[model samples]
Target: MIKGTVKIDAKICKGCELCIISCPQDGLGLAAQFNDKGYRYVELIEDNCTGCVNCALVCPEAAITVFRQPKPAKKSVEKK
Candidate 1:
């Protein structure tokens, strides 16, 4: 599994829910509170993330960024 994190650029978000419907994992959503611009911005429910990067793909402003954690190192097998 990828260790993924989603970031919402509050300055650029227009409170639209298009990314919400586009996310296959339901990883992204609209915030209940409004920002300084008097508009609601998107936020991430990090625990539910599947790292598909769907939110980034759907964002019109290219404001979202997803960071994936590197894979864990595999253990070496011992000779029997």
Candidate 2:
């Protein structure tokens, strides 16, 4: 379960919504404010991202970049 974040170039984004749809964790959404091009860009809406890069692969404009970090390992408990 590698967690990650997405960086989107709002100015370069064409508001195609492909990245938003491709995200598996539903981590992305349209921004509330418009970009320099007067188009609402995609943004990260949640922290449960898995760094799958699905959004980046589907993006036609190549406006999205993903950064991933390894998820912390869970502690194991011993039975008494």
Candidate 3:
């Protein structure tokens, strides 16, 4: 499985749910606390992330950054 993590710049977030809706794994949520601008930031909730970067693409403020682990390579069998 492809594993990944997300880093959200809470200060830059504008309380937009675009990232939440763009995530396929539902890994994002609104935080209980508020930012400097009084807008709740995005937080990671579920662990079913696939590093699809959908959230980052939809974020108008560019407050989200996704880090994805590389997938394992397949091995080939030699013919005897």
Writing each residue's lDDT as its tens digit, candidate 1 over 7-47 gives 88998888788888988777777788898888799898647
Predicted candidate 3 versus true structure: per-residue lDDT over 48-70, tens digit per residue: 88889899899999888889876
Instruction: Report every candidate's CA lDDT.
Output: 0.78, 0.83, 0.86
Candidate 2 lDDT score relative to the true structure: 0.83
The weakest ten consecutive residues by lDDT in model 2 span: 71-80
- TM per candidate comes to 0.77, 0.81, 0.85
Runs in model 3 deviating more than 4 A are: 73-80
Better of 1 and 3 by TM-score: 3
* lDDT by residue (tens digit), candidate 2, 1-80: 66788888888987888887878788898889998888888888898888899999999988888888744443222222
Top candidate when judged by TM-score against the true structure: 3
Return the top candidate by lDDT. Answer: 3
Off by over 4 Å in 1: 72-80
Each prediction's RMSD over C-alphas, in Å, is 3.5, 3.7, 3.6
Give the C-alpha miss distance for residue 37 in model 1, angstroms.
2.4
